[model samples]
Every structure is written in C-alpha cells, then in structure tokens.
Target chain A: MLSYLINGISLGSVYAIIALGYTMVYGIAKMLNFAHGDVIMIGGYMAFCSSSYLGWPPIICVLFSIVVCTVLGIIIEKLAYKPLRAASSLAVLITAIGVSYFLQNAALLIWSSNPKAFPNLINLPSLQIGGTQISAVALITIAACIVIMIVLTLFTNKTKMGKAMRAVSEDKGAAQLMGINVNGTISLTFAIGSGLAAIAGVLLCTAYPTLMPTTGAMPGIKAFTAAVFGGIGSIPGAMIGGILLGIIEIFAKAYISTQLSDAIVFAVLIIVLIVKPTGLLGKKIAEKV
Target chain B: MSSILSVTDLNVHYGSIHALKGITFEVKEGEIVTLIGANGAGKSTTLNTISGLLKPTSGKVELLGESLMGCPAHKIVEKGMALCPEGRRVFSQLSVRENLEMGAYTRPSSEIEDSLSMVYEQFPRLKERSKQTAGTLSGGEQQMLAMGRALMSKPSLMMLDEPSMGLAPILVEQIFDIIKSLNKAGTTILLVEQNAQMALSIANRAYVLETGKIVISGTGEELLCDEAVRKAYLGG
Candidate 1:
C-alpha cells in the first residue's frame, strides 16, 4: 500500500506540472489551447535529440531544449492563434487541434516511431527515510513542481510583465489602450507555459526513462484533465487537482488495477464535475450585462 | 489645437453591409468630443476602426498627422491612443488591479508603477476593490474600473464607448461628471453615447450620427438644441 501510494504520487506530480502550463494559458485566453499537449511532446523530443542524439551535456541539452520550446511556442502563437483570433471560437479551436496534430506528426517524421531510452540524468537513486523508501528522482520532481508553481505565481503576480499579462486577460482592449503591448504579453504567455511544459517533459522522461513520439499526448491529456479537474483557470487549483488526482490514482491503482487506473481517475473527474462544475478551486464567474 | 485624430470619408462594412458610411470627423487636443446617435448609428464602429479593432473599407485615419489606417490594435496602442471599449470587457477572472496593470503592458519598466498609482488616485473605489475580481463589480463600478484601466495606459487620446451605458440615472450623472472633470484635467476624450442630452451637455463638440452617417457636426450646444436631435433622441 505504501509503495503504491508513493508510486502514484510520483506519477501525479508529473501530471501536476504539465497541468500548470494548461491552467496558466487558459486563465488568460479562455481557450483550451489544444496544441499545448503536443508542445510537451515537442519539448521531450527536443531534450532527447539534444542530450542523446547531439551528445550534449545533460544540463546544456535541457537549457537549449527549453529555449527551443519557448521559441516554438511563440511562433505557434503568432502563426496559429493570432491570425485566427478574429475568427469564431470554433475556428480557433479547430486551428488548435490542427496545430496539435501537425506537431505530433511533424515530431513523428523527425524523431521516428520507436521508443528511445531517455538518459537517466539522476539514475533513479533511492533513499529510505522514516521507514519509507522514496526515489530521489521522484522527490526531485515533486520539489521541482512545487518550486515552479511558486515561481510562476510570483512571476505572474509580482512582476511587471506578469501584471501586463493579467491585465490583457482581464480586458485586451483596455490593456492595449494602456500601451501594454497586448500581443507581446500573450505571446510571452505561450512561451513561458511551453517552457514549463518542456521542463515537465524532461522530468517525466527521466522518471520513466523511455520516450515515444506520442508519449506527450496521453500525459498532455492527463495534464489538461488535471487542470480541468482542479479549475480550468486557477493556478493553485491546478496544482491541488494534480496532487489530489495523483493520490487518488495511486490509491485506485493499488486497490484495483493499472488498466483501470486511467478509467478511475477520469470517473473521479466526472464525479467532481457533477459536484462542482467549476472544478475544485474554480470560482464561478458572474457575467456583467 | 491641431487634429489629434482625423477620419476622412471612412467606410466600413459588416460583410458587404456598409456599416460606417463615409464618416468624417476630427478631434482636437484637450477637447471632449462626443458622437451622439440612436441604436445602430455606427458610433462604436468609428472608434473601433480608429483603434484598429476593425478595418475600414475606405478611409484615412490620422492621429497627430500620422496615418493610423493600417495599424493593428496593439500597435495603435503604442502610438498613444486607448479605447475603453463598450460593454466593459474586463477580464472577469482578474482582479481590478490586474486589469489596470494590463493597460500599461507596453510601457518601459520605469513607468508601470507610476501609471498604476495614477489610476488608483483617479478611482479610489477601484483601490478598495483592487484585489477583487473585476467581473464581480456592479455596473457603475465596472465602468469606473474600465475607465480607470484605460487611464493606466496614459494615452494621448482616450476614446470611451458609452460611459453611461446601463447605469442607474444617478450613476449616469456621476459618470458623466467624472468625464467632464477628466477632460478639465487635460485628458482628450472622444465619447460615444445614446444618451444625447448628457453626452452633449459635457462635450465641447458633438456629432449627430444616423445609420452610419454623420448628419450633423456642431458644438455640443448645437446638437442639444437641434430640432431633429431633440425630437428623435432627447425625447423632445
């Protein structure tokens, strides 16, 4: 039972990291950004190509991958979302899906179909403490997740750029009128969110030590699910949802079965929705007439 | 003294339906100019076109003698014109403070905090609810927040669409009074209103629009006393 609990937590922590990216983007844009998940896949592969294929040092590979992912994210925003912004939501949604598929397929063409072993950056070191053995890598991921969340919270709320983002999300026209460079702010959001996803990809791939072109799809979906499970747009809520979902999955997997683990987690989401449509931490928005 | 904005023979279409029909107007610095009209009089479209939210089919939009006809909305912002859009499209999830912060997104790092404090002083009510979500405010409060958010940008020209929209009669008076006061304090305002009486009362100049055409252009008093405007809009 203890083992299952720890294992679930390790997996859940990853889900939570990926979910943060989604929550942040949605909080501002009010669109799901279907391409976001694929961006994670791109990040993972970029790391793989940089570290293993290019034979670069692990740290350099991660840094370069992050930069590349951020640039790609910004490009995606400029080309895909910005152009379609004036169109209906349906058009934008379709565009997002298109971008997702295009990235995944493009990744397939570049990275090939077979699974690649992600270099064990930390090599799965384990320690026994207080009668519980925890993998150092999992602990690092959890710590990293917490640190990223706090940093992002501070970045969004305390920094001038972040304030600009909050303003644009609140009212684009007004934000622009303030000379806030509304377009630049939104593009920055995509870049930052995608950069975070890149880090999550590295952490996730390290924990698992395997890669597939479509690996990001399932994890991405799960992260998005985590975001919605908490509250689609709340930063704290996404983190909380991710941890809770991870714990729940751990318990369910241990008591039930791994195949049913995915189903159980999704079922819990449905149940949560039935109880609170806004997710666990989501506040209901009152429409101004 | 010179035109801060000039729209000459501006034409806009909503997919082949000529919405703004060859509209022409100019706003001077330190003046509160209003465009008064009934429903669907293309008042908002004129502002949207100037602000680059909508592309005019055929027209020239010049600000400070420079062309603004082809600029995007964000670029238009950089040129020092802000639009306090109709319907108070405040980021519903963001706090009132964040909304104001967005208004200065493009400024250099040095100016952001100063602009923020300036907005706070203008609307103490916003300061009280600075941490509250903007959408949660009452209509009058939301309007104030919207106007406050726009002011945070420190624009050379500020255009507001219907500051009196959907407010209690008393609140409408308070908002217009604020507009007049802001103008007196040296903010050039281009106002649009269906409430012809209140709008014209405060406007230095007013244009009476009819179905996308500017039928009359005169001083605010001219619009208020005009037989057509008084009978059709100001309830005789």
Candidate 2:
C-alpha cells in the first residue's frame, strides 16, 4: 500500500509538470494549447537523440532537451498561435489541434514509427524506506517536482516578469497600459511551460524505459485531465489535481482491475465536475458591466 | 506654454460605427484638460485613441512634438504617458502592492522600491491594505488603487477616464481633491468625465464633445458660466 502511494506520487509528479504547462498557457493566453503534449514527445526524442546519437552525458542531454523544447515552444507560439491572437476562440482551438497533428506527423517522419529503448543514464541506487523498496529515480522525481513547484510559486509571486504575467492574465489592456509587453510575456509563458515539459519527458522515459513519436500522447491526455480536475487556470490546482489523479489511477488499477483503471480515473473527474463545475479552486469571473 | 499632447482631425471607427469623427484637441504642458460629454459622445474613444489602445482611422496624435502613430500601447507608456482606464480595472486577484508593482513594470528594478514607497505615502489607505487583494476593495478604494498604480509609472501626462463613476458623492469629492493635488504636483492631466460640473471646476481648460464633435472649447470658468453648457451638461 505504501509502495503504491509512493509510486503514484512519482508518476503524478510527471503529470503535474506537464499540467503546469497547459494551465499556464490557458491562464495567460486564454487559449487551450492542445499541442502541449506533443512538445513533451519532442523533448523526449531530443534527449534520446542526444544520449544515443551525440554520445553526450545525461546532464548535458537534459539541458540540451530543455533548451530545444523552450525554443520550439516559442517558435510554435510565434508561428501557430501569435497570428491568431485576435481571432475567435474556436479558430484558435482548431489551430492548436492542427499544431498537435503537425508535430506528431513531423516526429513520425523524422524518428519513424518504431519505438526506441531509452538508455538508463542516471545510475543512482535504490533505497529502502519503511519496509518498502523505493527506486532512487522515484525519490528524485518526487523531490524535483516539489522543488520545481516552490520555485514556480516564488517566481510568480516575487519576480517582476512573473507579476507582469499575472497582470496580463488578469487584464491584457490594463497590462499594456502599465507598460508590460503582452506578447513577450506570453512567449515567456510558453517557453517555461515547454521547458517543464522537457523535464517531465526525461523523468517519464526513465521510469517507463521506452521512447516513440507517440510516447507523450497518453500522459499528455492524463496531465490535461489533471489540469481540468484541479480547475484549469489555477497553478496550485494543477499540482493537486495531477497528484490526486495519479493516486487514483494507481489504486484503481491495483485494487479494482487494470482494464477498468482508465474508466475509474475518468469517473472521478465526472464526479468532481458534477459536484463543482469550476473544479476545486477556480473562481467564477464576473463580466465587467 | 507649449502643447504636450495634440490631436488633430482624429477619426476612429469601431467596425461600421464612427466613434470619433474628425475631433481635434490639445493639452498644454502642466495643465488639466477635461473633455466633458454625454454617453456615446466619443469621450472614452478619444482617450482610448490617445493612449494607443485604439488606432484612429485618419488623424494625428503627437506627444511633445513627436508623432504617436504606430506606437504600441506599452511603448506609449514607456514614453511617459499613463492611462487609468475607465471602470477601475484593477488586477483584482493581485494584492494592492502587487498591482502597484505592475504599474512600474517598465521602470528599472532599483527604482521600484522608491516608487512603491511614494505610492504608499500618497494613498495611506492603500498602505494599510497593501497585502489585501484588490478585488475585495470598495468601489472608491479600487478607484484610488487605479490612480495610485498609474502614479507608480511616474508619467508626465496621466490620462483619467471616469474616475468618479459609481462612487458616492463624498467619495467623488475626495477623488477630485486627489486629482487636483496630483495636477498641482506637476502631472499633466487629460480627464474625460460625464460629471461636467466637478470636471470643469478642477480643469484649467474644458472641451464639450457632442456626437464626435467639439461643440464648445473655453477656459474652465467660462464653460462653467456659459448658458448653453449649463443647460446641456451641468443639470441646472
């Protein structure tokens, strides 16, 4: 039972990381970035390529993946999203779906449809805690997520750029009037979100040990589900929702049935939605009269 | 005195609606210029255009003898102009201090603390609630926060749109006092208001806008005593 909880938390942390990207893009840009998951797949491939082809060290590969994903995220924003800033939400939504398909197909063309076995670069030994043998990777994953969450909170609450982001999210016109560059802020948001997605990609591949063009699809959907579960635009809400969703998935698989686990995970979401339409932390926005 | 802001033959369109039709105005250095008009008379549209929120179809806007065409709203603010927009759109989720911090977004990091202290000194009530979220503030307090946030930018020309809207009479009088004091302390102000009587009382010069055209332009005292102005706007 304890092992299940720990494993669930580690898996959930990966989901939490990806969910942050979705929630943040939604918050500032007011557009659901459906292509966010594809960025994760790209990041994983970048890391795999660096390790297998470039013969780079794991730390360097991680850094390389993060940088590549950040630039890719920014490019995606500039090319696919920026032009549609003034367009209808439905148009942007379709465009986001288009971007997702574009990235997935691009990956298939480059890496092919074959799944690559990911090399275990980090060689830390497992540790026994409370009669349960826990992998060092699992421990590191949990610790990294907590640290990242703290850093993100401080960045948003303390830094000028972060405050400008919040201001832009609240009121774009008012933010521009206050001398904040809205386009720049939105770009930074995508960069940060994609960078985190890169980290999540590496962590997820370490645990699962496989890489493919479609690797991020299932996790991406789950992370998005977590974001919605926690209330879409709230950062802390994403964290909570991701972890909770992970635990529920793990328990449902272990206790109920593996085949029915996905169904059970979604059932919780339906219940939460039925109980509170806005998720847990979402505040209803009153339209200005 | 030289003109600080000049708008000549400005025309704007919201889709097919002609919001501002060839309106012209000027604000001399260190003076309070008020544009008083009825609802839908292009008062807010004029301010929005000057602040770079809306682009005019055919017109010229110059600040300190420099053309303002094609300047983004943020760049306009960086050039030392600030607008406290209509309806007190404060960052309700942010704390009062955070809202003020956002106001100084273009300033150097080193100067932020100084500006924050100055803002707190100006609105001590805001200082008392610096940690409180702006959404919980009262209507009058939100107005003060909006003004205080604009002041943090250290703008040479501060444009205000309907600062007294939805406030109690006493609160409105207090807000006007703050506006008067701000102008006295060397801030050029361009005010747009439906409350013509109070706006005229504090303005150095006034322009009466009617259906996207300037119907009357005069010194504040002259406009206050003008018979037509009184019957049309002053509720006499």
Candidate 3:
C-alpha cells in the first residue's frame, strides 16, 4: 500500500508539471494548446535521441530536450497560434488540434512508429523508508515537482517579467498600456510551458520506459484532465489537482481493476466538475457593472 | 509652453462606424486640457486613438514633435504618454502593489522603488491597501489605483478617460483634487469627462465634442460662463 502511494505521488508529480503548462497557457493566452501533449512526445524523442545516438550524459540529454522543446514551442506559437490571436476560441482550438496531429506525423516520419526503450536517466539505488521501498526515479520526480512549483511561484510573484505575465493574463490592453510587450510575453509563456513539458516528458518516459510517436497522447490527456480538475487557470490548483489525480488512478488500479482505472479517473473528473464547476481553486470572475 | 501632444484631423473607424472623424486637439506641457461631451460623442474613442489603443484611419498624432502614428500602444507609453483607460481596468487578481509595479514595466529596475514610493505618496489609500487584491478595492480606491498605476511610468503627459465615472460626488471631488495637484506638479494632462462642469472648472482649455466633431473650443472660464455651454451642458 505504501509503495503504491509512492508510485502514485511520482506519477502525479509528472502530471503536475505538465498541467502547469496547460494552466499557464490557458491563463495568459486564453487558449488551450492541445498540442501541449505532443510537445511532450517531441521532448521525449529529443532526449532519447541524445542519450542513445550521441551517447550524451543524462543531464546534457535533459537540457537538450528542454532547449529543443522551448524553441519548438516558440516556433509553434509564432507559426500556428500567433496568426489566430483574433480568431474565435473554436478556431484556435481546432488549429491546436491540427498542430498536435502535425507534430505526431512529423515524429512518425523522423523516428518511425517503433517504440524505443527509454534509458533510466537516474541510476541511484532504491531507497527503503520504514517497511516500504521507493525507486530513485520516483523520489527524484517528487523532489523535482516540488522545486519547480516553488520556483514558478517565486518567478510569478517576485520577478518583473512574471508580474507582467500576470498583468497580461488579467487584461491585455491594460498590460500594453503599461508598456508590456504582449506578444513577447505570450511567446515567453509558451517557451516556459514547453520547457516544463520536456521535464515532464523525460520523467514520464523514465518511469514507463517506453518512447514512441504516440507516447504522449494518454498522459497528455490525463494531465489536461488534472489541470481542469484542479481549476484550470490557477497554478497551485494544478499541483493539487495533479497529485489528487495520481493518487486516485493508482488506488483505482490497485484496489479496483487496471482496465477500469482510466474510466474511473475520468468519472471522478466528471463528478468534481458537477460538484464544483470551477474546480477547487478557480475563482468565479464576477463581472463588475 | 510647447505642445506635448498634438492630434491633427484624426479619423478612426470601428469596422463600418466612423467613431472619430477629423478631430484635432493639442495639449501643451503643464496644461490641463479637458474634452467634454455627452455619451457616444467619441470622447473615449479620441483618447483611445491618441494612446495607440485604436489606429487612426487618417491624419497624425505627434508626441514631443515625433510622429506617434503606427506606433504600438506599448511603444507610445515608452515615449512618455500614459493613458488611464475608462473602467479603471486594474489587474483584479493582482495586489494593488503588483498592479502599480506593472505600471513601471518599461522602466529600469533601479527606478522602480523610487517610482513606487512616489505613487504611494500620491495615493496614500493605495499604500494602505497595497497588499490587497485590486478587485476588492472600492470604486473610488480603484480609480485612485488606476491613476497611481499610470503615474508609476512617470509619464510626462497623462491622459485620463472618465476618471469620475461611477464615483460618489465626494469621491469625484477628491479625484479632481488629485488631478489638479498632479497637474500643478508639472505633469501635462489630457482629460476626458462627461462631468462638464467639474472638467471645465480645472481645465486651462476645454473642447466640447458632439457626435465625433469638436463643436466648441475655448478657455475653461470662458466656456464655463458661455450661454450656449450653460444651456446645453450645464443645466441652465
């Protein structure tokens, strides 16, 4: 039971990281980059290529994936999303879906459809706590998630650029009036979000040990689900939502059936949405007269 | 004093609607110029166009003798023009201090602390509620926050749109007093207001707009006592 809890937390940490991307993009751009998951897939492939083909060290491979994903994210925003800034939300969402498919097919062409074995990036021995054992990857994933959350919170609260992001998220025209470069801020948001996706991708693949063109699809959907479940645009909400989702999925698999776990997880989301329409932390924006 | 801002025969359209049509005005340094008009008279539209929030279809806007035409809103701000938009559009979720901090985004980090203290001094109420979220502030407090936020940029010319809107009569007086003091301290002000009597009272020069056209222009005292102005806007 203890081992299952640890596993649950580790998995949740990855979802939390990915959900940060989703929540942030939604908050600032007011658009869902459904291609966010595909960015994770691309990050995983980038890491796999660096580690296996170039025989790079693990840290270098991780940094390479982050850089690639960051640049790719900016490119995607510039090429695919920037033009649709004034379009209807429905249009942007469809375009995001198209981008997702485009990234997937592009990966298929470059890396083929075969699943590659993901090398264990963290080789530390498992730690035994009390009567239960926790793998080093699980421990590292949890620690990494905590650090990322702290850093992000500080960045948003303490830094000028981060405050500008929050301002842009609240009111674009007002932010521009304050001399904030709205387009530049949006691009930075995409860069940061996609960079985090790389970290999530590496951690996810390390845990599951498989890399494929379609590897990011399921986890992407789950992380998005976690984002919504936590109250879409709130940062702390994503962490809580992601961790809760991880524990639920693990427990559902352990006590119930593995085949029913995904279904049960989604069912829980539906119930949460019905009970609290804005998720847990989402503030209901009341329009002032 | 030399003109800090000049608008020449500016024309603007909102899709098919001609919102601002050939409007011209000038605001000299250290002057309080008020544009007064009824609702939908293009008062806000003119301000919006001058601030680069809306593009002009024709003519020119120059700040300190440089053409501001085609300059983006953010760039216009860097050139020493700041607009306190209608509706007190403060970042609702952000703290009052954070909202003020955003106002100085174009400034250097070294200047931020000084700017912040200056704004805090101007709006002591904002300083008191500095840690509170802007959404929770009273309407009058929000108005002060918006003014303080604009001041954070240390703008040479401050443009305010409907600053007294939705405020209590007492609060309106306080806001006008602040505007007066700000202008007295050497900031050029371009004010837009529907409160014709109060606006003209403090303005060095005033323009009366009607249906996107400037129908009258004069000294504030002259307009204040003019029979036509009193009959039309001052509730004769």
**Which candidate comes out best when scored by DockQ?**
3
Ranking 1 against 3 by DockQ, winner? 3
Mark the 10 consecutive residues where model 1 chain A has the least summed lDDT.
A171-180
Q: Model 1, residue B178: displacement in angstroms?
A: 1.9
- Ranked by DockQ from best down, the candidates are 3, 2, 1
Clashing pairs in 1: A170-B91, A178-B103, A178-B153, A179-B106, A180-B105, A180-B106
TM-score of chain B of 3: 0.99
B26-143, model 2: which lDDT tens digit per residue?
A: 9999999999999999999999999898999999999989999999999999888999999989999999999998988888979989988888887899999999889888998999
Tens-digit lDDT string for candidate 2 (A36-148): 99999998999999999999999999999999999999999999999999999999999999999999999999999999998786779999988999998988889988998
* Superior by lDDT: candidate 1 or candidate 3: 3
The Cα error of candidate 2 at residue A206, in Å, is 1.3
Worst 10 residues of 2 chain B by lDDT: B114-123
lDDT of 2 at A171: 95
TM-score of chain A of 2: 0.97
Candidate 3 runs further than 4 Å off: A285-289
lDDT of 3 by residue, A31-90 (tens): 998999999999999999999999999999999999999999999999999999999999
